[model samples]
Target: MNVGIGLPIGDPAALLSWARRAEAGPFSTLGLLDRLVYDNPEPLVALAVLAGATSRIRVQTEVLLAPLRDTALLAKQAATLDRMTGGRLVLGLGVGGRDDDHQVAGVPLTTRGRRLDGQMEVMRRLWSGQAHGDGAGPIGPLPARPGGPEILFGGFRPAAIERVARWGDGFLAAAPPTWAGGLFDTARAFWREYGRDGEPRLVAQVNVALGPDHVVDEARAAMHAYYAFTGRADHMVAGLLTTPGGVREAVTAFAGLGADEVMLYCYGTDPDQVDRLADAL
Candidate 1:
């Protein structure tokens, strides 16, 4: 499987440096996570900036919260970004589980799934040059790719996995390989059930921390802080791959399960970790 690197949670000043390093390394994509109520930079804008700074590597939202945004505006923004980036954008979206995020965005938490379902159709139509209403013109500029940038859906629920066949180009498994294999299978099954012509792209993400004890500890702390809202930070922390061998093993396991790409989610802030990870892998 191709390996991608996530933008680490660290000094904002170092983010560009980190992205540049990741591009120069063996990584295939630069992935970012999204949270409306979090202190981290917004994934789309940050990724656009990063994409401008890098030449070859793909830029993606590992999973952006789709139900929190205005659908039409999001379609326009994503399309513009895709056009500007020369089709390097991979938009991975999910109906986020965090209530606070929905609350902050003024979106109803209970309606997120329905909202995402409707929004997907609307966005697709807009991207395809359909007007919003009788007098309104179509949104522009069109995406670099004809049907919009390649979209991947991320979520644990069956309905969410089914969306890959109905609306998405692939599945983004945010869980570890062991837990995510079943989800990936469900997505593929749905794809076949819908009579899709080819296989749905399967991508897996794993939390990773590498380097000296202090840097690794920093990564552990960052993960705990981010996932603290789930009340399962310890469980998430327990799954982190800290050693070089562990990273290699996780990549191999995900690849064995037919993941097209494995996103190594680095939580440490150090930009040099990119080089270290490249050497390790």
Candidate 2:
């Protein structure tokens, strides 16, 4: 599996520096996690800036909450970023689990699944230069790739896997490496069942914290804040690895599972987290 790092979303001032640090390290991709009701940079905009900062590293939305945004606008944003990044953008779509995100978007949570399926069709068509509603012309600054950025979706539920086989390039899942093998197996099985012509790309991501005693503590604190919405922050805190040994262990375990890429998300936003993880992996 290829190793990648998430660009820290906090401290917007330091975001680019973190991007540069990750690009300079052993990371193959720089990823972002999207949150609507949180203090975080808008992910697509973040990539627009980071695109100019690094040339070799691929960029992805670890998983973006697609149903929350207007599909046409989202397609335009992603297409522009793909052009700017030289086709390095991998779009990961999902109906986020947070009810508040849907509430704020004025989107009914129950309809998200169906809406996302339609949105995927719309976005892919728009990216392919298809004419829009009425007399609107094809989207400009066409995607760097002819068919548009490679697309993936989050989760491995029956419906989600069906969506992937029908429209997406692969599956993007989040779980500790040790717990991911079964998930990968299920997705690949469904990929074949649907008669997709080739193997589906599988991406896995895990949360970690690797640094000094203080930074480790800070990392846990950060997770507590982020997962507070789930009412299981304490549960998540207990599993976060805080050492280089733990980080490397998970990466190796996931590599054995055949993940196309496994991204490590630092619980702490310390820019040094990038170098530390690269060294560990």
**How much does each candidate deviate from the true structure in C-alpha RMSD?**
0.9, 1.4
User: Tens digit of lDDT per residue, candidate 2, span 1-281?
Assistant: 78888766658778788889888888888888898999888888887788788898988897899999998888898898898888999888888888889999999999999999888888888888898768888876689988789888888577876777888888887887666888788788888888989788988888887788887888888889988988999988888888889888887788788888888877687888887887887
How far residue 144's Cα lies from its native spot in candidate 2, in Å, is: 0.9
Candidate-wise lDDT, in order: 0.91, 0.84
Residue pairs in steric clash, candidate 1?
none
Please report how far candidate 2 places residue 186 from its true position, in Å: 1.8
What TM value does model 1 have? 0.98
Best by lDDT: 1
lDDT, candidate 1, 1-281, per-residue tens? 78999887567668899889888888899999999888888999999999999999999997999999999899999999999999999999999989899988999999999999999998999989988777888989899999899999999989999999999999999898789899989999999999999999999999988899998999999999999988999999999999899999999999899999999999989877898889889
